[model samples]
Target: MIATNGDLERGAVDDQVVVRGAVGDDLAGILSVGHRTWLATYEPIAGPEYVAMGLAKWWTSDVVTDAIRKGRTLVAVLGDEVVGVATFGPQDDAVVLWKLYVLPGHHGLGIGSRLMDEVVVQARESGHDRITLSYLEGNEQAARFYARHGFTETHRETPGSGLPESVWMARELGEREQS
Candidate 1:
């Protein structure tokens, strides 16, 4: 439902990227973004084994399809390419952002922020009081990005696999908007 496109100044030509709900057709692009970003972002920080474990476990057709079918996944597309992705849904008392990643080449281009803004809007519209997410401890980029979006660290959990601890963060939704 968060279908919106913005023209960003890139070199001399404008690039239009749209952020919208993911569909079954988006499975491949979603997987690609997840795989590329996972490799580029985590392979160094968490080691190749850790990155391999994640790719094997998370970046699968079945998982991405389920998220899309649930109507909780969003994808940022430039023309026909999936440049970024985010998926979230109810987790206990709050809406937990299960995943959010942008292609490394697309970083700092506001695509992630646009996806996040839509997530916050959707969460608020759904009557949620807060949005929670977790990032690997050493992913400073993620930590700073989420913090910039007003999320504060709540706790950390050790998943135990020679992997870094997952740092949980949350941002209060304040009040729900009247429909």
Candidate 2:
């Protein structure tokens, strides 16, 4: 999605959300939304300690800033509030979706879908044939969400980090639709 001031303008039409490239200024907002989403979505399934450890190791401001700098991070905004975030980048020879999170309060608003659409568009534009991502096994919400978006589980592995088994999923990126 194109980044523009009009996209970030206040009083966005009701239920009208925009997905755009994240900027360095969005690090704190991204971190906050990510942490809140993780706590609400994963804390119960993985426990607070594991969630804390993962967040501390992965959601640092520096990491988010670097991703933004690389143009691999996208943020979903409604009015001036950030409701979701998606991050993806090249891994080996393919694009790997590293993170896709939406605030709990914003669930069911199609923010995740919009973010995934942007990710798919980015992957396709980057000349990738497929995009891959992993989710903790037993996360039915995540599994269903990805399945609905055309991703299929290809494999499972134990991360050996006190976390549950991880399920790897991938979706083929076919021809992009002409606008």
Candidate 3:
């Protein structure tokens, strides 16, 4: 259950949002963030069935616990509430961003951008050259967000199960988003 804080280091993103690695005490809040964001964002774009499958596969306590224990999960906290979550880890030659989601109500407040910034910082500190992520092809918001963060389309994959295509994207560590 990752009883200790797993050491990705911690910092405040701003006066309102504290960005930190997940601890055992954060399991419930992290799960809540994931469930809420998935329902609010993906249910509309990917359908209820797809949402159900995703929640079952990715939002479980066991999966999140594993991520937290690995020191690869970060949470954005607004006061005492968990408003966002991101999980990433080494994949081949780069870091693969397995998950990144901010609560719907918190969108446009720069929470996700702050999370991405920390991800790039951490990846560079860990000596990675690039980061990779994939979003559902139908999710235009995600597409725009990743593009704004300097990610470009690397490829696409049809997951075949009536699911939307996955639009894979990557960004080199040397690049920075235009502010």
Q: What is the TM-score of each candidate against the true structure?
A: 0.88, 0.87, 0.90
Superior candidate under TM-score, 1 versus 3:
3
Best prediction by lDDT? 3
Runs off by more than 4 Å, candidate 3 = 1-13
Q: For residues 91-145, could you state the per-residue lDDT of candidate 3 as single tens digits?
A: 9889999999998767776789888988888899889989999999889999999
| Predicted structure 1, TM vs. truth | 0.88
C-alpha positional error of residue 161 in candidate 1 after TM-score superposition, expressed in Å: 3.7
Global lDDT of model 1: 0.85
Residue pairs with backbone overlap in model 2: none
Question: Mind giving the per-residue lDDT tens digits that candidate 1 earns over 1-179?
Answer: 22233434442112477899999899999999999999999987899999898888888898889889999999988877898999999887789999999988777777888889889888878888899999998899999899888889999999886789999998888843221
Q: Per-residue lDDT for 172 in model 2?
A: 81
Which candidate has the top score in TM-score?
3
Each model's lDDT comes to 0.85, 0.83, 0.86
Model 2 bad stretches (over 4 Å): 1-15, 175-179
Backbone clashes for every candidate come to: 0, 0, 0
* Consecutive 10-residue window with the lowest summed lDDT within model 3: 1-10
* Deviation of model 2 at 40, angstroms: 0.8
